[model samples]
Target: MNSVQSLIQPQVLAQIGFAGIVALTLTGALIAVFPRNILYNILGLIVCLTGVAGIFVYLGSPFIALMELLIYVGAICISIIFAIMLSRPLHLSLPKRALPKVGLALGVGAAVFIMLSAIISRTEWQPAAMRSSDWSIATLGAYLLTRYNLVFEVISLVLLVAILGAIIIAGYARRSPS
Candidate 1:
């Protein structure tokens, strides 16, 4: 339709898209941090991560974006969901929120926010004169394996241990009475 075309100019559309992505990211972050439900928090985190991936695409690195999607949204969230399923009933009663605890948390959050805002506002930001804009997955993998091999290995071992511990816990739970 002419109306649709009129509203969707390419350059303006790109800026609108960026704004929408930023809105999505902020909305997700707020939902993740402020919600009472654990599942809602996880879903919000996924949304935030998806928005971050879109931002990475805007920044010219789709590989990192894909990894962000695969690792955080796919693997981590799925594993967390499985863990929740294995450990607790869907109808488990949530603990009542204590007012004093919530007030303390809010005070801490406010303090951190003010401190960070001041730091960020005062700090200077400048782009490097020469920066490599490589977005290749192969290059990223090579760098991780070569330069950050120890970190990669440690993370792998940690994941392995976590998976094994989950299995053991599940096995024990299965043998016990429901």
Candidate 2:
């Protein structure tokens, strides 16, 4: 019983959970980028977003986590999947990767990674001076409906427009023979 208790310690469990979440995020990112299949890429993106939501929960922001899951994974990804399904046949082969473009992308990704690493290492991250006590879901909803309503509506409109544009473009592509 003592050994079992030691194995089940909170800190140990937390560390394991964090490691698993990080692995999930990395795996999803790799799947998203490396896959040639569009469906696989979307699935990977959903996995990555889910991992991010898990991270948010681990960081004590359940509201943001739930929003991530709902907005990104639930709404956006599903819409993308629908667009893909409506647009093209799953068995159609995509164009082969260009080596030069791949190299350029790698270079850019490395540069951005290095730049972000330097900035993160240099910056002094501090807590807010005045922490708000009213961080409940109800309060956040009220604020979104009241103060940030315009921004919220704008974002929704943008997403809708983007989705519509994708559908139109896909339809056009389908109509035009390669």
Candidate 3:
């Protein structure tokens, strides 16, 4: 009963959610990269950004997660979609994959993987002698309220200005004689 209860706990649920988010992110990234269609790529990018917001939540920053969703998906992706709509359409006939290019890509990937593995295996990781334990949620909250408050406010102001600028530019483009 206790084991079952533990499995249904918030921590376990969060772990499952994290795994799902990671899967979602990877799927979106694959879709974004593999598809030739511009619209599909943009949609995939939105999905991927949403998944990344989930990841930010998993990493213990819901504020960052919300900001990520708002900035990337809400602002950037929407702007991109609007731009796509306004721009001249590229005739997107699918091209056949070349065998030599595929082979060369695979070869390079394998070489990079092997090199990374060798470097990682050869390296000895040692913790810093004076590593600080100042990464607690309490410390984070305190810092946000105190030390980083001005920085946060400045960033928020900048983002607001940027968003307004983007909107104005977009609107101006619409109003201008094409």
Model 2 Cα lDDT, one tens digit per residue, 34-133: 8888878999999999999999999888989999999999999998898777656753567689999999999999999999999999999999999877
Task: Tell how far residue 155 is off in model 1, in angstroms.
Answer: 2.8
TM-score of each: 0.77, 0.80, 0.61
Against the true structure, candidate 2 has what lDDT? 0.88
What is the alpha-carbon RMSD of candidate 3 to the true structure? 5.4
Query: In candidate 3, how many Å is residue 141 off?
Result: 12
Lowest lDDT block of 10, candidate 1: 86-95
Query: Model 3 over residues 14-114: C-alpha lDDT tens digits?
Result: 88888899999988887876777878888899899899999998876788898999989998999788787776564255567788998999899899999
Candidate 3 to truth, TM: 0.61
Which residue runs does candidate 2 get wrong by more than 4 Å? 1-4, 156-178
Across 56-164, the per-residue lDDT of candidate 1 in tens digits comes to 8898888778989999899988888877776687526556788899999999999999999999999898889999877678888998999999999999999899878
Q: Give the range of the ten consecutive residues with the poorest summed lDDT in model 2.
A: 169-178
Give each model's whole-structure lDDT.
0.85, 0.88, 0.85
Instruction: Give all candidate RMSDs, comma-separated.
Output: 3.3, 3.1, 5.4
Quote model 1's TM-score.
0.77
Ranking by lDDT: 2, 1, 3
